[model samples]
Target: MSERTAQLSVRDGRWTLYVALMGVPVSQWPEHHFGAGVVPTPSERSRALTGLGFVFTDGATWAWEEYPEQPDDDTSPVRLLASIRVRSRDGSWS
Candidate 1:
């Protein structure tokens, strides 16, 4: 088991959370949230990610509280882009 850094970005007005191992994308969540304020519950998102061996490397509190402000249009600003760390189920780092 190995771990690596992951990124969360906004693309095409959607949230995309992804991790790559050995330069290959291993896990990705393209629709982490339907909208800024419409984000899933922390437990719900965590449960979905845990299956991929990803636990929010940031504090749990932050994960729950930190969210990107929704873009009102294509030219709107993106305020919630972030990079996070992820480890394998066995607690190893890549």
Candidate 2:
């Protein structure tokens, strides 16, 4: 599958990455919590997941996450993604 990345600006207000799978937010999905990357990295995807888990991507309307078993969220690898619109901090697409 092709993966896309988007950077969001929280200058207006803090944002959250909302992944809509099957027309429903992944967070709202059963046992699904977004992952954040904490150890600062060059990768936008890594940066987001490093610390800010589940935060929305820039201008992202929908996102994608791999919940271990596709639907088996309880014991899944719920990674973060930018689906709808992947933008960057400088108002550009990543």
Candidate 3:
């Protein structure tokens, strides 16, 4: 058998984008140890949704949620949240 290493993937990139877009304020969560500032384009946002394993509900909405691997019980607080709400110049959220 060959050994395999766990390398970083697109999911990790998406998660990083998600945290930045949500304005989670890294200062408050130093444990994550993320530096401030991120500016992604509309295309980048769309790519992240798919990369992060989000389900596309419509043209503009994407969502992702799931329990951690190896849960201790049936009721572990679900790791869930909706992400990305794009708005056009006309002032409408897509």
Candidate 4:
């Protein structure tokens, strides 16, 4: 997998985009249900983006860049960043 690649998942009415590194758990919560099958179809990806209030063009690939290195004291190799919601007006999320 690419260093900049991430996975998308929905749980408890919130959608999240995060990178999964080796030896790291996808999510601490068992309900997160990580490692699900990939969404290979661009149409489906577009649909998911639309449903999540993100702009996505069909047949376009979603790209991300490598994250900057963390502080020296942060020794953990595992890193994760996620956007739990994109369209919620009130910041309400599950």
TM-scores for every candidate against the unseen true structure: 0.46, 0.22, 0.26, 0.28
Model 2: per-residue Cα lDDT over 5-92, one tens digit each: 3332221233343323345554552222333434122354444533433333445453344334356457664444334433233422
lDDT of 1 by residue, 71-92 (tens): 4465555465455556666564
lDDT winner, 1 or 3: 1
Number of the top lDDT candidate: 1
Off by over 4 Å in 4: 1-15, 18-43, 57-61, 68-70, 73-75, 78-94
Please report, as a residue range, the 10-residue window in candidate 4 with the lowest summed lDDT.
85-94
Clashes of each: 0, 14, 0, 0
| Models ranked on lDDT | 1, 4, 2, 3
Which candidate's TM-score is highest?
Answer: 1
Q: Give the TM-score of candidate 1.
A: 0.46
Worst 10 residues of 2 by lDDT: 2-11
TM-score of 2: 0.22
In what order do the candidates fall by TM-score, top score first? 1, 4, 3, 2
Q: Write the per-residue lDDT of candidate 4 for residues 30-52, one digit (tens) a residue.
A: 12223345433445544554454
The 10-residue segment of model 1 with minimum total lDDT is: 59-68
Q: For residues 1-94, could you state the per-residue lDDT of candidate 3 as single tens digits?
A: 1111111112333324432222346443211212333434446555544444332333644444465434887665444333544322232211
Off by over 4 Å in 1: 25-41, 57-79, 90-94
